[model samples]
Target: MKTKLLIIHSSDELYGSDRILLQVVQALRDTYRITVWLPVDHQDGKHQLYRMLQERAVEVQHMDMPILRRALLTPKGLVRMARLAPQVARKLRSSGADQVYLMTSACLLLAPLARLAGRKKTTLHIQEPWGPREAMLLRQLAKFTQQRIAISQTVARSTGFAADQLSVVHNAVPRLDPANPPKPLELDADCARGPRYLVASRWVRHKGHGTLLKAWSMAGCPGTLYVLGSAPDSANRIDVRGMVAEFVSDTASVKIIGQVANPQDWFDSVDALVLPTDTVEGCGLVALEAFRHGKAAIVSDSGGPAEVVDNGVDGWIFTAGDVPELARIFDRCTASSLAAMGEAGLRKYEEKYTPERFDENMRAEMPGALLGS
Candidate 1:
C-alpha cells in the first residue's frame, strides 16, 4: 500500500510556501498517496494552489486549522477552536495518513493534531522567520516532530531549532522554456528615458513596493518601475493600491500589472527584477526567477535575499528600506552592467536552480521524510 501524506498548509494562496508545497506534491504524487489540507474555506479552481493541485489530479481538502487565527483569540472564537481541533484531528485519523506535512509556523497546531490522529511522523516546513509567539509555539512543536525544514539558513537561525533537528533546503525553480529564451529587452523607447525593472509578488507590506517607490523618488525616477503582483487571499491589512499612490511622487512612473495569468512573458520585457523588501523576507524566490530568465535582480539586503544574490556577481543587494542605497544602485547600474549581471544570474540558475536539481536534492536529503516506516 502507498504511504499516505496529509499535507497541511496555512493558506491556499500560491505564495512562496504554497509554491514549494505545489512542487513537492507534483514531484511526489506518483510515489505516495498525497492529500493536501489547506486552512481556508472552500475555494474554486481560481485559487492558484488548489487549481494546480487539481490540474495534477491531487486530492485537495479544506479545513480551517485555527492556530493563531485572530478570531480564535476572542471568547467565542476560543470556544470554536476548542471544538474544532478535535473534529479535525478525528477526521485526520480516519483519513489513514501515514505521515503529516505542515507548512509554515501558522500550522504548528498540526504537530499536536497529527499526534492525536496517531500520525507520529510529522514534518513542518518553515519558509519565513518566526515572530516571538510563533517561535515559542514552534519550540512546543519540537517535542512532537523533529522533522523540520527551513527554506534558508537565515530562517533556520531565526527558529532557534537544533542544528540536527532542522534541515536547510534552499527553494528551487523549474527550468525556463528553452524555446522562449529571454531576448534583449527594450522597455524604454529612449535609452535616456531610464532603466526599466519589475517587482512581482503579493503586494504585502513586507514585500517592499513602498520602499521601491520611495527609492525611485529619491533617485529622481532613474527608470520606470513595473509593479506586478496581486493582493493575496490571506492578506487583510494592506491596502496596496493606496500605499502605491501614497509613496509614488508625481515624476515617477510605476505601472501596476496587478496579477497576470502568465508573468513569464513579462520577463523578456524588463531590464531587471526589483525586490526591495523588509526584514520579514523569505528566500527571494523572485530573484531565482530573474536568474532563470537571464535578468539581473536588485534585492533587499536582509534575510534570504543576501543568500540568493551574490553581491555584484549575479545581482546587487542594497540595504533594505534604505532609499538612498537603492537609489545609488539604480543610478550606478549601467545597461552593460545589468546585461552582464543578467548573464551571470543565468549561469547561476543553470548550475543550481533547475527542476532536476530540486528533485535530486529532495530525494537525497529527505529520503524517508514521508516513506519512513
Candidate 2:
C-alpha cells in the first residue's frame, strides 16, 4: 500500500499558489494515498481547483481550520486562534495519515499543532516571500516542521529555512495546446494596430498597478495595456480601475479586462506580459504562463521573475518600482522586438518550466520518509 499523506491547504482559488497545490498532488498521487483538506470552499462558485482534484480521483475535504491571515494577527484574532487550537489539534490527531503537508505559509500556524498531535513527519511549503516581522514569527513556527519546500530561491531565502531542511523547487505550468489556438480579443482598430501588453495579477497594492500606470502614462501610452484580474475580498485591495483613470488621460489606451476564467486566451493575443510587482514576488507564475504561450515578459527585479528572465535576452528586467526606467522600456519595445524575445522565452519554457520537469523535480526532492525510503 502507498504511504498515506494528508495535505492541508489554506485557499480553494485557482490562482498561482493554488495551481501549484494541484500540481503537487499530481506529482505525488501515484506514490502516495493523498487526502487534501481545504480550509473553506469559495462562495463565489470558483471551485476549479476542487473540481480538478476530483477529476483526478483525489479525495478532497473542506473544513474550518486555523489559517494565518492579517486578520488573525490581532488580539481578537489571537483569542479566536486560541479557541480553535484544540479543535484543530484534535482533527490533526484523528487524521490517519503517515505524513502531513502544509501547502502554504498561511497554513504555517498548523505546524506546531501537527507536531503536538504527534505528526512528526510534517512538511511546510513556503510559497510566498515574507516581510521581516512576519518572517520572524514564521521562523519560530517553522521549527516544528521536519521539511520545508520553497518554490524559488528568493522565497527560500526570504522564509529563512536552513539548507538541511529546505528544498527549492521552481514552479511550472501545464503546456498550452498548439492545435487549439486562442481567439483574438475584440479591440478597436487603432488599439489592434499597435503593440499590446498585458498585466495579469490580482489587484493588490504590492502588485505595482500604480507604478505601471504611472510609467504607461509617462511613456505617452505607447500601446494598449490590458489589465486582467480583480482584487480578492481583502483589505489590501487596490482600486485598479480608479488608478488607471487617475493616471491616463486617454481611457482607451488602458483596458481593464477584469477577472477571466481563461487568462491563457488573453496571453496568446498579447505581445508581451508585464509583471510590475513593487515587492518581492514569490514565483511570478504569470511569467511562466506567458513563456509557455510563446510570449515575452517585462518583469521587475524583485524576486523570482527576475531569476526566470534573462535581461535583454528572453525578456527585460527593470528595477522594481522605478517608474522612469520602466517607462523607458515601454517606449523602446516594438512589436517585432517583443515577438523575437517571446520566441526565446518559449525555448526557455520548454527547457526548464514544463510540467514534466516540475514533476520530476518534485518527486526527486520529496522527503524520503514520504517516499517509503
Candidate 3:
C-alpha cells in the first residue's frame, strides 16, 4: 500500500501557502494518499483549492475546533493542544499515515501531537521568518520535526535555522502557455506614448506601494500603472488610490483598477511586472507568475525577488526603497532591449518553474521520510 500523508494547513487562503499546498498535493497524489487539514472556515480560494484537490482525486478533510485555533497562539495554544491532543492522536493512530507535513508556521504547533500520533516523521514547511517570540516557539519545537523545508534561502537564514538542518526549495507554479494566452489590452499609439507596467499584490504596507508611489512620482512616470488587489476597507485601499491621485494626468496613466479574480487577464495587458516589496517575502510567487507569462520583472532586492531575478537577464533588480534606482531600472526596461529580456524570463520559467518539477522534488523528499514500519 502507498504511504499516506496528513498535510496540516492552518488557513486555506488563496495566498502563497494555500497555493503551494495545492501544487504539492497534485504532485504527490500518485505515490501517496493525501489528506488536507484546514482549521479555518472556508473562504474564496479555499473553495477553489478544495475543488482542485477533489478533481485530482485527493481526499479533503476539514476540522473545526475554533477554540483550538484561538488557543494555538497564546499559552492557550498549548492548553488547547493539550485538550485537543487526544482527538488528533486518535486520527493519527487510526489513519495509519506514514508521515505528517505541517504547511505553515501556525500549524507548527501540531508537531508534537503528530509525533505522538505514530507519525514516524514530521516535516515542517516554514514559510515565514518569525521574530524572537515566534522563533523561540520554533526553537522549542524543532526537535519534534525530522525535516525543515524553507521556501527560500533568505527565509531559512532569517529564521536562524542552521544550514544543514534545512532544505531550501523554490516554490514552483504551473508554467504558462507562451503561444496562446489571451491577447493584451490594445493601446492606441497615443495611449502607448508612455511606458506600461503592472504590479499584482495585496494592498498592504510591506508590499511597498508607498515606495512605488514615491518612485513613480520621482520618475515622472507617464505610463499607465495597473494595480491589482482586493481592498478590505477604504483606509487600506486609500494609499493606492492616493498614489494614483497624485499622478495628475488625464490619460488614465495611473489606473488603479479593483481586485481581479483572474490575474492572468491583467498580466496579458502589461509590458512588465513590478514588485517593490520592502519587507521579507517568503517567496515572490507573483514574480514567478510574471516570469511564467514571459514578462520581465523589476523587483526590489530585499527578499525572494532577488533570488528569482537575475540582475539584467531574466529581470531587473533594485535596492529596496531607492527611488532613483527604481526610476532608472523602469526607464531601462522601457527600452527596445526589454522584449528580449522578457523572452529570457519565459525561458527561465519553463526550465525552472513547473508543477512537474515540484512533484519530482516532493517525491524525492517525502517518501523516504515516511515510517518504514
Q: Each model's C-alpha lDDT?
A: 0.78, 0.87, 0.74
Q: Which is better, 1 or 3, measured by TM-score?
A: 1
RMSD of each: 2.9, 2.3, 3.2
**Which residue pairs in model 2 clash with each other?**
none
Positional deviation of residue 167's Cα in model 3 after best superposition, in angstroms? 1.1
lDDT of 3 by residue, 1-373 (tens): 8778788787656678888998878777788778887764435544766676677777876675232233345875667556776887777688677788888767765777777776778888888766666677666776688888888888888777678777877889876666756665655452465667788888877788877877776676657777888555434444678666764344256677767666786776677788999877778887888787778888998777899999899788999988788877766556356667788988888777777777777778765543222
Residues forming the 10-long window of minimal summed lDDT in candidate 3: 64-73
- Residues 170-248, model 2: lDDT tens digits: 9999887778767677655645547899999889999999999999999989989999999988889999989988988
Best by TM-score: 2
Poorly placed runs, candidate 1 (over 4 Å): 42-45, 178-192, 231-252, 368-373
Among these predicted structures, which one has the highest lDDT? 2
TM-score of each: 0.89, 0.94, 0.89
User: What is the alpha-carbon lDDT of model 2 when measured against the actual structure?
Assistant: 0.87
For lDDT, candidate 2 versus 3, the one ahead is: 2
In model 2, which regions exceed 4 Å deviation? 41-45, 178-181, 186-188, 191-193, 367-373
Estimate candidate 1's alpha-carbon lDDT, on a 0 to 1 scale.
0.78
In model 1, what is the error at residue 354, expressed in angstroms? 1.9
